[model samples]
Target: MWRWILERLDEQFPAFDVDRWWGIDDPFERMIGSVLVQNTTWSNAAKALAGLRERSWLTPQALGSLSADDLIPAIRSAGFQQAKSRTILRLVHWLMQHGGVGGIIERQATTEQLRSELLSLKGIGEETADTILAYSFNRPTISGDAYARRLYQRVSGESLRYKQIRHAILDEIKTWADLARLHGLIVEHGKVICRKRSPRCEGCQLRPRCLFFDHAKRLS
Candidate 1:
């Protein structure tokens, strides 16, 4: 099922690049964009990231030096500016105290260990932590977003927790590249086909295997 979905997405978005999805190259920038993307669209988050980059404030030292008030304007487009600014500030402080971005990247800790540490921080939830683990650290982990969650639930006819879904995907797909590509594909599929409202189900490639579509057809 996962492979089928990925293949369909590949056909749909031939030029998809997981790294380009967030418009960030550096691991730290990716982590920051992950946080900024919470409860917001990627375009808005990208704007905020661009703002930070333009000011040369995308670094740990620059973010750590600024107060939340000073940071709010740059990230206002991402929504919940005050809260996100606080989260970013806290993350920067934590990173600085722990030996900056390089220190964390160079640490000999396992992915699980790093994930645990990230989860212990203020605004870092399971999804965000998993994203950092996957994109930032190049770990073989699923960063299950809302798009993936909804798509999986409809496809499997099971409503599982985020961690449960992540574990299930990891069990089936273990390579970092596959996991990353699957994440990007799932997100793109959600946006393009299995949308939340008025989903384009009639000609969707996955309609044959989609539990929701099958059930709807049966009911009709």
Candidate 2:
């Protein structure tokens, strides 16, 4: 199943890239933006991030200064704005208290170490932590949110939860590069082919091996 995905992605979108779409180079900024992206569309998240950048509030010091109220309006487009704002503000404060970005990474923190720290913040979860680790810190970790979980379940006919699915995929994925590429592929595939309902499987590269597609065809 995994190989099928790689083959399809390579064929259909030869130039498909990952890090570029996220538009976040800084590990710290990616961490913050990952939280902002929760349950929200990328465009809305980008808007909120743009607002943050406009105010020079993308860093710990600047963001830490915002009250929940002040921060909420800027991210209002990104659903659950007030709650997300609080989470962002609290996370910034915690990062600062812990000696900031250099302190966290320079310590050679384990994946679990960073995950625990991020999870301690209000809104950060396993998915968000893995995203921060992979997209930001360059950890060879798998990020499984709604899109990821749904796609894998549909393709593999697996009942694995995010944690289980994450471990399963990582175990099978041989290289750090593959992990990174697959993460982005799954994200893009979910958006374009494996949508929540009425997914466009016929046009999908993975249609040859996708379980959902096979099952639906068999029924028909």
Candidate 3:
């Protein structure tokens, strides 16, 4: 079901290129944006990121030199300024110590190891960790965010937990590119069609396969 859904989505929806979508092509900047985006909308996070970019603080070395307090002003738009500042500080320091993502790749580290490392930090939760892993490191895993949960539940007739959904998708994904595409497509689907309330089941191309649509049909 997941694989078919991915193929159909790829054919129907515009491809989600993270670098193009975020407009932050630098891997390090992408990682920092991940932190800024926590508990905030992407536009607010983009504002924080743009502020940092204007200050040329997106690099690990540049950001690592500053204290968490210094980041609050630039990232104030993204709520939880204090916590996010500290989290970004810790992440930068940790990344620098590990010799950057390139170095970590040279070490042939597994995705699980990197995920565990990220989760150990102050503000890095499962979703954030998996996001960094998938988007930044190009790992074959998806963030089990609300969009994913709702979309999957509606389609599969199964309500899985965050970690459960992630692992289940990983099992079906053979490569990072496919995983990224699947996640990107899922986000689009959730936002435009299979929304949390009043989903446009009639317009959704996947209506035939979606359990929620089937149920809705019975009720109607």
Best by lDDT: 1
Stretches of model 2 off by over 4 angstroms after superposition: 1-4
Q: After superposing candidate 1, which stretches have Cα over 4 Å from the reference?
A: none
Residue 172 displacement in candidate 3 (angstroms): 0.9
Candidate 2 clash pair list: none
Encode model 1's per-residue lDDT on 1-220: one tens digit a residue: 6767778778777899987775667989988998999998888999999999999999998899899999999999999999999988888887888797788878888889888988898888988889888888788888766888899888879887788788878878879898998898888778888899988888587887889999989999
- What are the runs in model 3 whose C-alpha is more than 4 Å off? 14-16
Top model by TM-score, which number?
3
Model 2 scores worst on lDDT over the 10 consecutive residues at 1-10
Backbone clashes for every candidate come to 0, 0, 0
RMSD of 1: 1.9
What ranking of all candidate models by TM-score puts the best one first?
3, 1, 2
TM agreement with the true structure for every prediction: 0.90, 0.88, 0.95
lDDT (C-alpha, whole model) for all candidates:
0.86, 0.79, 0.84
Residue 22 of model 2 has an lDDT of 72
Writing each residue's lDDT as its tens digit, candidate 2 over 68-174 gives 89888888878899889888887788788878877766667777777787888778888877887777667778776677778777888876788887877777775
1 against 2, candidate with superior TM-score? 1
